[model samples]
Target: MGTFGCCWKIFGVALAAIFLFFHDLCASEKAPNYTFMQNATAAPPISYYDYIIVGGGTAGCPLAATLSQNASVLLLERGGSPYGNPNITNLSSFGAAISDLSPTSPSQRFISQDGVINARGRVLGGGTCLNAGFYTRAASDYVRNVGWDGKLVNESYEWAEKLVAFEPPMREWQTAVRDGLLEAGVLPNNGFTYDHLYGTKVGGTIFDKQGQRHTAADLLEYANPSGLTLFLHASVHKVLFRIKGKPRPVAHGVTFRDATGAKHKAYLKNGPKNEIIISAGALGSPQLLMLSGVGPADHLKAHNISLVLDQPLVGQGMSDNPMNAVFIPSPVPVEVSLIQVVGITHFGSYIESASGENFAGGSPTTRDYGMFSPKVGQLSNVPPKQRTPEAITKAVEDMKALDDAAFRGGFILEKIMGPISRGHLELQTRNPKDNPSVTFNYFKEAEDLQRCVQGIETIEKIIESKSFSKFRYDFMSLPMLLNMTASAPVNLLPRHSNVSMSLEQYCKDTVMTIWHYHGGCQVGMVVDRDYKVLGVDALRVIDGSTFNNSPGTNPQATVMMLGRYMGVKILGERLTSDVVSN
Candidate 1:
């Protein structure tokens, strides 16, 4: 058999049985009928809604759905629906959606100031539509630290989980990866859990046995469709604020451009409880704030935007969890998998793996995941936009020297949790549609580099463990393969080739984003404990933008949970205020 063929047998006895059960359960569930959904062009030039939500994404969809149970809500999405998109709905074509370079692609690709290629969600379901299907909640300590009620958090998780999450059916490669993690002494195996534990475990997935992805957009099934006005391709340009209030500026309305280049305005109704919320992701929330004159006064002035509030921390404290990986080219073709198993270390790092064809495609001549591929731009000392085909192949080919085997193997990856390193974001132009310039400054702090070193060491141990020996060529560790470059060894690290290589420099050179970036409109900085924007009335920021750190290994579950939790809280507040008013 060829290295990349899939004719190999699928599952062991236990796994095959598990797969059949989940296939029946998940295949029955489908996306909700969004009866209130419409294109932005269908909206009236001026509209009034009890609550207006910008960005119909991961958090916004649930929030709007929940809020609609009592009050009228206007949900604005900058991108089209994910409902009928095969690239997003099917797991067989895992990498196709995000890798599509078209202007209308559901995932928006951007290179950070750190020169790392990254992507952000552009579809209605947000990053949940683009991510590998892992689903896990924040740790118990994380909940308490953030001052959330434990019982309520669990309830919220259950609500979201029941709709989308599933017990992933493990295949051969993932099962072996699980055993290897245990063999490396990441001990006390907590089998099949969603809690963030300090041991090896199998977690929940958004993909079911039939390979269909259930995204955050699926949470809308719980929504009151009658009261929810969902408008797709509604690009919010600026937040409308009533600046002449007594104590601080108040958010009253928003101005948005519809899909056809026509402008529309939506205002909050005459009630103190009515408000506007920014549920855009980490990047979009801060960018919209700055555009609306709520960010740093000096930075806003650079583009001649009138200052609404001089909240200097609006775009401060940006972060992206730095990910490093060791790509292992198996002599045998491995079963296709996403992140199903994890090894959480005592130190702040996570180990996860994925085996399949390339995210972009399976063609041997093409580059795969940029993080795992040989970045010709780095070797040639040229920017990514400046690289050519001939220069790219010649410059970095010597470093990695990989071949078709790369298309057939899996990657063991590490991502540092709660990195101390930080960076800031700023506007590239005044236009809200244009991407802003941002830098994560990965490994900027010395401690972050040390964490990366520890993570790399753990990966080495896993690679050398007894359980994993069968997968490697001639029972060689990653380090051994690089040393004996004679046999076309799959060089995981391009810049350095031997055991004596500086782990620190290797970490810096090979750092990539796992896309768990958070903290632009952070809690206590831009928003309060209730997630309300500081110094602004009738305004709040929900979504990953308000997070202090990326929760657990995956933030999608918690991010969706927050939307439901806060919606309940806000609804309660409304009821209490009505009682007092009466």
Candidate 2:
């Protein structure tokens, strides 16, 4: 048989099996009566509802669930059902989604913005449904530094743990990545991964035990709250809030336009008791705010968008991590299994089963958890290179000699990322269709540039460690990124907003941002400690955009935690205020 025919037969059998299994489940257990609809008419506005959350993604899902407890809530998502989307449902074949949508088209591969590669999802679950499923939490010091009440972080962290069922996979899947790093002495002992959580070399992958990803849609579906209404493919264009000399301008509703240019105003039925929350992704949320005239007055004027509130910090503190991928060729095929390797569990069961463990903290299984800082156990092959007393003293002396800004940068690294370069996120254009021009002014700070050099050096050492002695792996050497003649090897560094530098070329080469954008619209700049967009009433932002500082991690779980926390605060305050009035 031809290759095409053979593959087709295999695919057909797999599809049949999936359908049969789900059919059996449907027979025994009751699935929610959630029907996928498109371009549906607005539901009758009976009276003022509790909350109207826009952009259902990582944060929006849990927010909807939490708010739906007491009052009626509405969730608007721009995508549809993720049931059969080839990219979302299948776990083993997850990489298939990374490929271009068009089959047999090599030229139409997954391209990143400005060539900086990163994964972004468009389905109901948002990026979680399509991401690598690496579960991790944010560092604690980073959270405390945000200047919010300690209780806020504590409550959110606690609630976030329960809502997402964040846990690691089985230990079998961790592999020897950590061992290799340890053997190479790439990871030191002093690096703190999280608060009171020490870094360790535990090799495994944390994934949803169900062989599928649970997204916001899944959570909402499982909640199956009759009071909450979900509107898919409904793109919110603007948030309409009244601001004519009131104690706090109430957010009435939102104005959204469908793909067909048909605009509709979704308003609360009763008085001005309802509020609007914008949980759109970093780029989309800020753009929506700007379009609604809640951004910088100067920039809004340029876009011909009238200024509703002169919130200078609206889009000012934009930041993102410029990510770089180091593809390590495995010496042998990776073993695959579905035995609940880490602390994670089946999505539906996890949400339903709650215990004291759920309330304490979400990190139940750390077997395959993603490590933000290098753990010594995970670095089994690396040699011990503890900083000597003399070296520590000298390092402190060197730190004292640095300028305050440079010192602050270095201190942040010592506390959070150890040593890594910094970057900036820039607004590309006002045109929503055109992707925001993100210029990660990576390797911009001299201190940060030094950090990049050190970081590369550390990664290189880890790859060469004795832990990988058994496996003969191929090492991809980074090319010289500086000004070179045409005769040199093809440089893969163009896509990088920052580049690596030898000790000598540190002053010259510019590297790419690691695709880590945070701090734009930081707490003081964009909003207060509560995450409300400064100067705007009834509207708030709770996404990666509101980060006061980079979490120095993958950022998904952290974003999830923040969303849950902010939702609690918003809902709790509203509930209490309503009670007092009544």
- Top candidate (TM-score): 1
Candidate 2 runs further than 4 Å off: 1-48, 100-119, 147-173, 186-198, 201-206, 221-224, 244-250, 269-273, 336-434, 473-516
- Indicate which candidate wins on lDDT: 1
Q: lDDT of all predictions, in order shown?
A: 0.75, 0.44
The reply for model 1, stretches above 4 Å from the true place, is 1-31, 357-406, 475-477, 480-499
TM-score of each: 0.87, 0.68
How does model 2 score by TM-score?
0.68
Candidate 1 lDDT over 124-219, as tens digits, reads 888887777789989999999999989989999999998789999988788888898898888779999999999999999988767777877888
In model 1, what are the clashing residue pairs, if there are any?
A: none
For model 1 the local lDDT of residue 104 reads 68
Instruction: Kindly state the number of residue pairs that clash in model 1.
Output: 0
